[model samples]
Target chain A: MIRFLSILFILVSNTIFSILEIEILKGSDNLSKVAFVPFGNESGIEENYGSQISKNIEKNMLLFGEFENLAVNEMLSYPSSENDFYYRDWKVLGVDYSVIGKVNSVNALGNLNISYSLFNINRRIKILEGEIVGSEDNIEDISKIISNRIYEQITGLRGIFDTKLAYVINSDADTYQMCISDIDGKNEQILFTSKAPIMSPDWSPDRKKIAYVSFENGLAEIFIQDLQSGERDSIQALGMTNSAPVWSPDGKSLALVVSFSGNPDIFLYSIRNKRLVRLTNHYGIDTEPSWSPDSKKIIFTSDRSGSPQLYEISTKSKRKKRLTRDGNYNARGRYFPDGKSIFFVHGNNGNFQIAIKKLSSRYIETLTSTSLDESPTISPNGNIIIYATKDGSNGYLGGITLDGKARFSLPVKNGSVREPAWSPLLN
Target chain B: MNKVLTSLNTFFLILLFLSLIFSMFSFPKLNIDETQSIKVNFYELIQQNDILFDPPAANTLIKKEAKKTSAINEKTNADETSIISKFKINKLDIKNEITKIKLSKEREDILRVSAIIQQRISSIWIKPNSLSESLIAKVLINLAPSGEILNFSLIEPSSNTSFNESILTAMNKMTFFEEVLSLERKLFEKNFRNFNLVFKSSGEIE
Candidate 1:
């Protein structure tokens, strides 16, 4: 018994002392390379829909410059099925992932079936595969579905290709138009056109309507425009000025700014009963109120401390806490998707730029270098930020990935584009 | 009586365990004759010549015993103090030399290979963004002697799904480590055959 016990004890101790451990703290700064091969087709489609669908998916995946793609000419072979797909080909090209698909025949309902697969070359395994069915004419929608799946599988982030953006465009000195379009700046729709100025456009949580400040009525008023019906309604807020309307997470109320006798303070307006509740009653100027993701607190810009700084107020207790102190002008603060950090416009040495600050830390990080960058809007995934920047006296929308690795701008509109609001993702 | 026997047995068991651990890891022991030592008293040797020339003392037994001690002095022929003064050896210096020359050579091999493996993983791991919460995930890797990765498992996972997926994706991209081929076969089996990788997101906290 004694000898047996000693052996067991020695074995346990040896296992504990023999293992090795390594610590890794850094990650690659390079974007992953993806190869999108031209899909195959069964005997039913005529217009070469396979290539068109693959091309659209490729464009969507590379829209934000988060990934690198292998050119079609660089590919050695076009593999549409698993049998034809070979990992050796992609590995030689240094491609990390390969995407292939085949367009099946139309069904009885005239819906085309497309099957897609994504493979991790090094692991030699099919990471994702699925079939999507849609109308024959809606090929773009089907490609979006497939791209979303591939993106989700690879990056573990929600697919954001189908999301839209809302911004105000000024075509002329007098004409101000409210517009909503796809994130790629396609499928543009003019919701409201007025002779007065339009500002502070926001999307409701449900994404069925948009709430923005339109000055067409000779006073600053907030209007909710229905996307499908092109109908607009004003939420008769009790004030001389009601602007900066941001929807709460629950889609039940709006955290807006109201100026009562030149005192601009934040208020919450109920969309159903048109009731207004005072959230901030300070004599100082307070505006640009935005709700946290949890709807428990509202962060806004206030000059209560002798300068425009960011502050958050609890909804239930009405208790306020100062958020920013490093800069003299820190305003328009919005919580990140995760609610751990906040990004806002920070003015340093007379130059205004976009800056981010963690709630638990005191240091602030500047993201943009160009002065006059304002109205910064973050994607739902919190991976990208698009702000209004000016080039040669013309305002345009500029975007950058959160990692600071990629910077790109939206296609220049004929009019000056300002105040870009990213729409919420549809469930 | 029963309690005393059990206690005595446990004491012997503990002593045996301690001795076993020391023998396995400590330096080799040398066989030296510790019982016989040369004791050279400089004061007595200098006085012995003077006393021999002088008259005999009244206590003759004491004088004879002193003479006998002087005759048995083995170090009388050489100056032991001068020899030691010429070559002074620090007690701590020997211990330090043993660790520097004997232990560091083995440690240097593992350090060089571990750094290369760490850098390779860092070059392929595309960390996800906006992970504000500090997270740690551990992955266990098993490698063959040919420097090829045999298997890996996420033994520990963070609360964030995206963070965990990023680590797995990077690991899947690495197929061979080849740097391990330069390591000795014994060292490879002892340290690199199976190892744990601790990935930290807090290193890039903004």
Candidate 2:
């Protein structure tokens, strides 16, 4: 019995130590090569602050799939400042860009200051240099800020590294939890836990609140909760099914699906006046409403034409038009950042996959070749997409670029993760 | 002119009569028997009939005309030889022109060089995520005689820094191109020394 118990304990510990890992199934050949040297640090510091920062930056950069980072061992020299940098050394290593930094204690009260610089090895010029001063506990946040700066300066697009992700994890058959984590699935915190199933978690544009569906009252109801204070507010559904709440781009209103009229229809809920207006009165199901970037239109899925298809309705004029026509089943469509195209789930035969269609044309590009892929959410940069897919019997989150050149999977251990909603870039 | 013509006719007739008398005398030296008398009677009858012959002056004119015709033919032969030589020279000139055209048409080397550059750049280029399919960046490159990249610059920037940087990186990766060394110095300098390359995500260079 002792031997059996020890073996069981080892197995359990091993499983617990194995966290969700990102698997790069495909990579683009045109990625820029970058190197991150271990930051210089003084002794007697409790933590390896510089190393942590570099690692965090590396992880965040890799999530975009457009950068190939060099490992620490591959670096020929560690230069924390311009005086130590030799462009020829990095050039000989075939590195296009290099990043170096130094960490030092600012005061006796445990405050720290980090100075970093990004260099373009080919041009032999320093592209960016800055410093961040904060407490030790905020090291991760500071590193992400550095990453955002570098990404913006290099790519000419705002970085989503400082953004967050809200998802639902089904712990068991009857237990579900709404969780929030960093964009790379780190520093996760459970926002709300319930014995009943939770579905369709959405983030407010302000990033301070999250609106999601909870079944704690024995029926589906929408609740908006403050992320910091943990306070909740529910819309009055009046004994009807309410779900799939998406915040408007301006954060003044929400488009939700309610079944009070004996059928699921889209309704606009004004947060200021507490007024509810029904946008669609079709007898078929209308759900998954996504707001346009301009907040002038709402794209939602409706089955009024005998199959699930996407439709766009103006918020003011209440005009409606069908958007998708090729497939028999199309749903969960969201506008890209540019608002010129949309990402949606398309069904073909028995397989459902993620696809993108241009708003002004009939061209539709199916992004994922995997079956049963759904709920695609585009990154704020409009370059990458995160969606939920199934592998064998487990559900995992997958990401792919708009061009289908890079692909990766993030598989959660011990449970199934779904309904991934990528928050907007937080100010 | 009429008197001259008559005198020339009489001279030809006198010559013909003399030749006939000579031919009859030269026929036999009186060796004929009774049969020879019959032969002589036949000849006397022919002479009595007075068969007319061409005058010597007319024969002389015919001989002079034949000599003049032969001289004209010889002159024409010389002219024909000169014309044939001229034709041969023209044929040689045409052959030279054809060879010049053939040399100009054998310019597959330029295409081969472009293909080499395209293949090398595509293998090293990593397209930036922020770039769209429609975006194109025009880059200018300067090369030395030894296929070394002397300088690289972007003529028209795409305003997307990452995309431009990627193009630059690709160019830098191809530091030396050995294929350019095989080209003639003049051809290389005229065409490949300094040129513009249009970069697109489709891996096509314009």
Candidate 3:
């Protein structure tokens, strides 16, 4: 009986916990495998500067979702200089590229010098080498700079790690806060709070100020707040809803939506003259104005063609042209980095998701598979798009590459987050 | 009763021993001459690059060469006309020999090496995530004669990094191929020394 029972138990356990064979599909094809060796600390400082910088660079690379970094534990050797490097070691480990560095004390002014080198392991050649001198507080910034240089060298595109993101979180019916955070959603600083709704936060081209729609006085108003001074100025819509402010590329004027003429229309507000110029006089709802990259035209959502669709109007000629034809509900269209395509919220068959359309080819590509995906904002480099999505009862922010290859979600702990605006690449 | 049982057992043991001796001598031997002739025919077909052609054509070519050789052997003291014919046939045979020696061996070697490489690479290749079937990456591999990979470079990289990395990893996993060592040095140098492999998830070789 004991033998029979043991056999029965083994069979049940084997059936219940059968090994799962997951099919590994292909990963991104162009990603270079890079390993960051811990920099040597000849300075004798207590802080682990080498590990810290390496970790920071690794984090930035992971966030970019392009290059694959070798885990420190997988590294067989940590070579900080050319003499210590063994070509066969990294090659055997399948590392295509590697970065090595050393930190040393430069002077009595508490300045430290960092020398770093990047090598292509497969080709066994040195690609880049540089040195920087800075105090301890500047280490993080210096690391980010190094990351940007590496990213540019590998991808041939400028890195946007130093950029920021502005978004709004609705805590309750009566509480709302507009927050600004780093591109990776760190260092979140609450810029403003209001009992009424705060929506459609946009950054100026110069990154000095943010313009957003605020309902603090029980009426929709547009406010331009200086990020450094904590000062703000508002423009009253005069008993009409005014929202969806977008900055032109030149930072000279803002194109916004105002319903002052008894219907929603696009209006341009000039900072130099402090005057509003009405651009569209359509009877249907005209809102969500986004400027073209060249600043010569503005694309806005208009229901004049029966259902809401994207339409572009020239800032000079004031002539209008319809941009979207396929979807019955297309709105919130913003120009992609190249200005050839526009990313927007697309709605069909009770599902709202993000989509992109190329203007020249009239080619539309649906980006998100999830329902209720809104607030699609393209990254500065145009490689990624972040949007608001709902999973079950909770609303969170989700990001996806432009090719729909990689996806990630950033969920707020307790509140619903929405209206994500990816800031321009900051210095 | 014990005596009778021992006698019966001895009779059966004698029968088994006789059968074993008889079976050993009766085992058929493989015809060595037939196998040699078949090998010669195969080599002749390969030399003519006629392995892929109709069998009758190869047979005809063999018969023709045999008839010519016999004619030359039998007509050693023939007249002027027949001697001239023999000279022309000999010249043609020499040209055929040169062409066969130059082209057929190298072509066959190239085909064999390509087949071995494709099989080895496909066996170990693991596809990366988020790659479409349409995506392809061209990889150039430098290898020693023993099939030890010296270096790998992406000559035409795909837009997806994971796909390229997976191919490179697969190449690395197969540190060396034992099959490659059997190839001739000239063949290895002409074709297998440095080669480009186009990798796709479909596992189809073009």
Candidate 4:
């Protein structure tokens, strides 16, 4: 009996410890790792847009959430052609792909002879290359197309750099401004500014209107602003705390945190009826409601379980189930665009980082190590996450793909930036 | 007595270690008779562009019209066929050019293009399982070198308005020959552009 017990224990432990093979979409999740060397400026032009071109391409790649970018700071050598390409050096650095280009002018038209070739770092061979010409104004555009072409050659996804993001920039405590910016956080234009505190600006499913909580009335109110007309209207809500306005997948309703019955809850307001239907009812603060892609269920932060954790409630059944177990604080979770899992902030050891939990298995994985990481928003493709981080005293936005690589920070000019909601890809 | 217990414990540990080694080294029998098989289409492995254009019904119509005109010309002699035949061909070519021009010019109108473009691309996607209430298929399509749809596939699944099967069905029936703009076929082939089709079934016809 003793021998049998010993053997049984060993078998059980071994079976339990077997490595789980994660079935990932092999080519589907790959982004070409391209390095745009500071484009060699052979021509003494008054301005060199070659570097700008590379940066633009990088921004486009990042926006598409398709390609993993090799940090220029980490590149071993500047290689733009097959001869200069030391694939061994790049492979040693764990890079999977590389891009090199040179920019020069032939005449006054500001002709740029940009020769770039992509290479597979692992196989150590050039994948694709071509020379293109562009004026100074069109260099960035030309570079974007080249980056996209290279992206398609490797990962086969459309480049998203050409896409834009709609967000609300809080100019001051009273002045809440709705704005749209390039994915790199440039070319920001205020669509509409409100004297009230704007909270939770969400992109319309079509990327046109911004639904947000505006406080122009001294009380929290939800407003939807059309990007074109700068026109605004109050979204239908009967209760207080009508914040956390999220557009449903249909764009016909708004899933929001409302508290008309004296307790904050998640409610759905129909755009047609302008009527209210409560989805969650609890005395605890039930806020930060996000709609699943199906609009049949919602994932929101609720304190009904004695602590703030993520909960999923069906819109039809109203059946509630707790989704987080490991963390004492898990709030502000957003469903992946695929709706298979949720990415949220998990507080462990008094530090908050992004954690993902599958809906079916409840398996939890922590993806961020930085403290004070909040508002975890997945890209439109559901392949990466962008969230706010406090790099020391200043809050900056950083992003990491689903596999936990290609970590980079968005440059902030003035004060800290927070609450980045990845907009739907603008056609 | 204590020594005896210690010896027994050592023997147990040794047995445990041996068992672990045996299990690690052994290969379990995966009997053909006992194992069942199910087909799994690994969509994730294929990196196809997600360009979701409606079917090429319009292009088909254009081709049909061209064939019909060519047939009529075959039956008629050069003398019977006045310059009208020549003008008709030119008219058709000009119309094709205009369609291309309209598609590119209309690209700037995001809302209009999205609505109309979706209407033209009408393939329906059925949910594979019952547990799924509905699936939203966002298809991204790449244009072929010939200005026709090269390929298109769905994006994320959303049960909301994004998943309406009726819209997809309607789109599948459309030929966006009307949407194409006049661009050099070479230029079209060299660049990548995406237009989305939002398929939702309100069950109410628009």
Q: Per-residue lDDT for A1-427 in model 2, tens only?
A: 9999999999998755532211111213666789988888766767788888888888888885768888889888898888999999899888988999988665677788889999988777898999888888888888889899988877777888888889988878877889988888888999999999888898998899999999899888999999889999988854288899999998998899988756889998888887889998888889999999999999999999999999999988999999999879999999988787888999999899998887877867788989999888888888888999988977889999776667988647457888999998877
TM-score for predicted model 4 compared with the true structure: 0.54
**In terms of lDDT, which candidate is stronger, 1 or 2?**
1
What TM-score is obtained for chain B in each of the predicted models? 0.54, 0.54, 0.53, 0.28
- How far off is residue B105 in model 2, in Å? 3.8
A1-427 in candidate 4: lDDT tens per residue?
9999999999998755532111111111233355666666665756766678777777666663445677888888876456766767776675656777766455666566677777655445576778888776676668767876775555433445555665555545556666678676777877777776666778888988888777788778888888788888987577765889898998998888787766888888888889888888788989999999988889989888899998889999999988888868999989877687788999988899998776765467788878899877776756667888887876778888655535777767355566777788655
Higher-ranked by lDDT: 2 or 3 = 2
As for lDDT, the candidate ahead, 3 or 4, is 3
True contacts kept of 2: 0.20
Order of all candidates by lDDT, from best down to worst? 1, 2, 3, 4
Candidate with maximal DockQ: 1
Lowest lDDT sum, 10 consecutive residues, model 4 chain A, at A19-28
Ordering by TM-score: 1, 2, 3, 4
Interface C-alpha RMSD, model 2: 14.0
User: Candidate 2 or 4, higher DockQ?
Assistant: 2
- What is the full ranking by DockQ, best candidate first? 1, 2, 3, 4
> What lDDT score is found at residue B17 in candidate 2?
99
Q: Give the per-residue lDDT digits (tens) of candidate 4, residues B66-117.
A: 5667665454434223333333434454565577677666444433434434
Question: Which parts of model 2 have CA positions greater than 4 angstroms off?
Answer: A1-30, A42-47, A237-239, B1-107, B201-206
Per-residue CA lDDT of model 2 for B69-182, tens digit only, reads 888656655544444443444445456556656566536666677667767766776666644334667777788999998987888777567778867766666788778888
Tens-digit lDDT track for model 1 on B69-93? 6653333323333223222322233
